[model samples]
Target: MTAAQYLNCLQGVMQREWLRFFQQRSRFLSALVRPLLWLLVFAAGFRAALGVSIIPPYSTYITYETYILPGLCCMILLFNGMQGSLSMVYDREMGSMRVLLMSPLPRPFLLLCKLLATALVSLIQVYAFLAIAWCFDIRPPLWGLLAAAPALLLAALLLSSLGLLLSNGIRQLENFAGVMNFVIFPLFFLSSALYPLWKMRESSEWLYWLCALNPFTHAVELVRFALYQQFNLTALLVCLGLWLLFSLAAVLTFNPQRAAVRG
Candidate 1:
């Protein structure tokens, strides 16, 4: 496709996702509520029990809520990423995806546009959660929020790509709930979302290594550092690499022939 045509296709994909997002107001509310509950209720309960030592991106002791705020922000992206994939499944079943794929635009470009549009929507939720956290005094620096935008977007891209990759393998909507449980719970619970890696190490060495190797862990770390106006070369590199790898895999595995047969 020509540059102008490609831009038009991109705009349409984004507009579709944006309209779907607002049309489902409950989806928006639940996305905010899940993390807010963690920030307000769960974090409050754990604040006294969990003592965070001075860690990188942190110069002094910080509350548990403060430490997990980045993770909760990532949580918003994580859920929305999978939710985007769920919509893809629904679209395919309804024949809308086939129509999208039939466009003259290259499949990879079309898929990338879809991924980015979903990431943009996910960022809206992430920032909303961050704003709520700030009100609760779990604030990162104002400048950090600004600096973290690219990091958050990268993380959103990585997770959204991963979600698309998984969805490409799923042939039916009926099985998506199990897939979500298997993917989301393990990725979240096994990562540094709720606790630091060092704390996990104190409990079990193997579990710590699992958290270390999780891409979501790096995503959260990337956000954590960026939220403090700090740069983490390792986290940035990991997230970028995962984003490219997963996006490529998703595009490759998203076979229109197979989808046609299945449908």
Candidate 2:
């Protein structure tokens, strides 16, 4: 395809994904409600139980809610990414993916476009969550909001790429729920999402290292620091590196024929 055609394809896919997302209003509300429930109901109990120390992106103690905000933002990306990939499974089964994957453009570029579409949608849900968090007094600086955009987008790509890679291997939609539970919950709970890494270290050394190794942890840290108008080199590097790795793998292995055969 020509450059203009490529751009048009990208735009078309993104617009289509966005329309589908907005049409399913419940999907949007559930995306917001999941994080809000944690912030509104669980934060209070966790805040009293767990004390946060001064950490990067924070000059002093912060509430548990503040610490988990970035994690929750990542959560939005994680779920959306998985949902996007789940749609891939649906499209493949319904025969649409065969058409999409057969385009003249490189399959990798097309998949990248799909990932970006998912990222754009995830970013919207994330911003909406942040806006709602603002009403509850979890305000970060206004500038920080702008700073977070790039980081959030990067994290979205990273998490979405992971889902894409996983989706390529999944032959059926029904099995995806079990796979999502396996991947998502472990990534969320084992990382620095709800608590600091240092706190994890105090409890268990191996657990701390595992959390540190989690790409989701790096993604969370990347978002957390950006939301405070700060930079985290390690987190940025880890997230970007893993995104490249996952995207490349997803693109190489995005074989709908394999899924169709296995199904």
Candidate 3:
């Protein structure tokens, strides 16, 4: 395809997603509510119960709301990624997936565009959550907000790619319940999103190892350190590498034909 053709496709895909985002205004509010609920209600109780040791990116002991903000930020992205993939299943049923793939553009590029569009939408919601958190006094450095943009985008992409892989790999068998049970919660709860690895180790060595190995943990770490204006080379490399791998796998194994048949 010509350069203009590629640009047109990308623009169309992104515009369509954004338009839907606006139409379902409740989704945006719903996304914010999850994190805010945890931050305001759950974190408050945990703040007193769990004494958070001083960790990197923290100079002194921090409040639970402050410590959990990054994870909550990620929670937005995490759920958005799932929602985006869930849309893919809808599109497949409606034959939109077939129409999109029938474009003259390369299939891989088209899938990449979809992934990009999803991540872009999620990034906007994440920032909206962060802005609301700031008003509640869970503030990070002002410069950290700027630094977090790229980190958030990367995390969004990584998360969206993983979801895409699951839907694309597992043919239309049943509902998203399998994914929610097996993928989403496990990744979220097992990661360092809520608790530090040291604490997990204090509880169970194996659980700590699992959290350490989870890429979502790295994604959270990437955002956490970025929000403090610090760089974590390990997290940067892990998230980047996995995003590439997962994106590639999703693109390669993309089966619109099978999805269409099943849908």
Candidate 4:
């Protein structure tokens, strides 16, 4: 497709996703509600029991809610990404996938556009959660919020691409719930989302290593540092690399020709 045509296709895909998001109001509310529950209930319960030290990105001791804010923001993205991918599975079963694949645009470019569009939608939920957090006085610095935009977007792209990659392997909608639970909970719990890596190490060294190895952990760290207007080069590089790797894999797996050969 020509450049203008490709742009048009991208715009159309994004608009479709946006319209679908509004049509399913429950999805938007649930996305917001999950993080709010974590912030309001779960974090409150843990506040007294868990104490955070002055870590590199943090200048002083912070409340448990404050500490987990970035992780929870990422959690919003993570779930939404997988939800977006689940929609892909639904589309496939509904015969819409064939239509999308038959477009004049290159399949990889189309998939990339889908990934970008999904990432953009997930960002809306992330910022919404941040706004709610602000009302509760769980505020990051104003500049930190600005600095977080790129990091949040990167994290969104990383998770969305990973979700799309998983969706390509999913052959049936019936199995998607199982897959989502298996993938999402582990990624969220095993990372430094709820607690610090040091705390995890104190409990079990192996668990700490696992958290360190998790790409989601890097994504969380990228947001964590950026929320404080700081930069974690390691986190940035890991997230960037994983975003590229997952996007490439998703595109390859999404190829209709590959599916035909396998069939």
Model 3: what TM-score?
0.96
Look at candidate 2 and tell me the lDDT of residue 141. 83
- Taking the tens digit of each residue's C-alpha lDDT, what string does model 4 give over 1-263? 57899899999999999999989999999999999999999999999999899897998889999999999999999998899899888888776877788797888888988988999999988988999999999999999998999999999999999999999898889999999989999999999989999999999999999999999999999999998899999999999999999999888778474333233
User: Model 3 lDDT vs. the true structure?
Assistant: 0.90
For model 1 the local lDDT of residue 225 reads: 96
When 1 and 2 are scored with TM-score, the better candidate is: 1
Residues 8-80, candidate 2, lDDT per residue (tens digit)? 9999989989999999999999999999998889997889888888878899888889889999999899899
Best candidate according to lDDT: 1
- Give a tens-digit lDDT track for model 3, residues 175-202: 7778768988999999998999999999
Model 3 collision count? 0
Question: In candidate 1, what residue range of length 10 has the lowest lDDT sum?
Answer: 254-263
- Could you give candidate 1's per-residue lDDT for residues 26-111 as a string of tens digits? 99999999999998999999999999999999999899999999999999999999998998888887778888878988899989
The candidate scoring highest on TM-score is 1
- Candidate 2 stretches with Cα past 4 Å from truth are 258-263
Clashing pairs in 4: none
